[model samples]
Target: MSSFRVMRCQPLAREAGSVKKPLNHLLVSAFVYAGLGVASGLFYREFTKLNGFPEGAFTQLGLAHTHLLSLGFFPFLILLGLERAFTFSASRKRFGWFLGLYHAGVILTSAMLIVHGCLTVLGLESSAMISGIAGLGHMAITAAIIVLFLALRTAVRGVERPAAVAA
Candidate 1:
């Protein structure tokens, strides 16, 4: 292996002009997703009851609750841990883009699910446009995943183990 420096990998917060902005953002996103997930669950129950929808019937609202909790809340929590560990936000531009795209995708996808669910409960047919928009949201999520992978790769590449000191 090549020679290593003791202080090679420094936390971004320790760097000049750096802050914990990414961590804070990630934490807030996790909480927001958690809230959304709970609210969607409640909405599913209440809306179906109000509409006299049959019990045990499948609805997009149920899926939305799971999606919000699994895809939105869990992912954000995981990203928070990753950010704390690797400081991937050091790649500021990429991180920002990833955050914006990811949040947009989650919100768009969940919103469509809620709308479609309501339509179904009300016995109304949904337009193809809703499905199309959800597809676009999924695409955005896919792109955000790629961006996150690249950012994590960059952060990992920047990290180096300290060399042992000679006796």
Candidate 2:
């Protein structure tokens, strides 16, 4: 055991600068995902009103809403906030991977959900291919989430004190 004391950790020289490219990609992708979420909701509502809508189809479209917002909008929105607070470019490679995997997962999951929903509407049974694609999408999403957590966990710089606080 040791006496408690306040300590400071400084940002390194390389952990510098605001990067626009990643932020742009995050924002743009979020907007698109947001749109897809809204669109899926609309489709879900309309699809329900029609007779003989496959019961399973409802579940699939419902997931579109969930995955789009959670996988797409959620992470990007958090990253946008993080952008102002930390220099994520400090770990550019990791951040790039997070963005890539995340976007792909969001796209795949939502696309698969849409495909499944359409099949339900058409009264077609879900096939092996659809199930396989959905499974892969889920895996990608899980991987992306892990990457996001790891990237943020290590990349954050120690909090700097304000002049008033320091004084």
Candidate 3:
């Protein structure tokens, strides 16, 4: 009975179709980046006052924020924009595994790198750990980037091939 109620509360298939808007996603991503950038800059300034310089601690935090905002948030928005601009059919498809993988990679990598970098900077952890985290994060981000690139390429080809045939 409870399960039935939950199912009834869920959005209908048709309603779900209208929920994803590429432009809206882009705008939301832009807003998140802007907010995080401002917060990181302010935090850095505060840390400098307390430590007489931006401490390794603050730097790591700032870097994390920057990456989250720029690579994680902004790239997602950019991807959405590209999908719309290129009319990618996959964009219209349900939340796909590739999208999940891309986002998970971004979030997990960013978190690990940020925390490891911060701990190393604070002298609480070894440089080796930091390096390892950074390496892993880079690999994850690279994978995400590759996925996005492939998706974009597919979308563009779909658009271009039809136009070429028509001509």
**Top candidate (lDDT):** 1
By TM-score, highest first, what's the ranking?
1, 2, 3
Candidate 3 collision pairs: none
- Against the true structure, candidate 2 reaches a TM-score of 0.75
Off by over 4 Å in 1: 1-13, 165-167
lDDT of 3 at 78: 68
Model 1 residue 159 distance off true place after TM-score fit, in angstroms: 0.9
| Clash counts for all predictions | 0, 0, 0
Window of ten residues with lowest summed lDDT in model 3: 4-13
* lDDT of candidate 2 at residue 109, scale 0 to 100: 74
Please report how far candidate 2 places residue 141 from its true position, in Å: 1.5
**TM-score list, all predictions:** 0.89, 0.75, 0.60
User: What TM-score, to 2 decimals, does candidate 1 have?
Assistant: 0.89
Model 1 lDDT per residue over 1-167, tens place: 56754554554445544656778889999999999999999999999999899999988978899989998999999998888778888898899989989989989999999999999999999999999999888998999999999999998887655666654
Estimate, for each residue in 1-167, the C-alpha lDDT of model 3 and write its tens digit.
22322111111123334546645655675677567656755665664555454444344656666776777566766666565566443544322534555556656666665566445445575567656766766776677566656666666665532222221
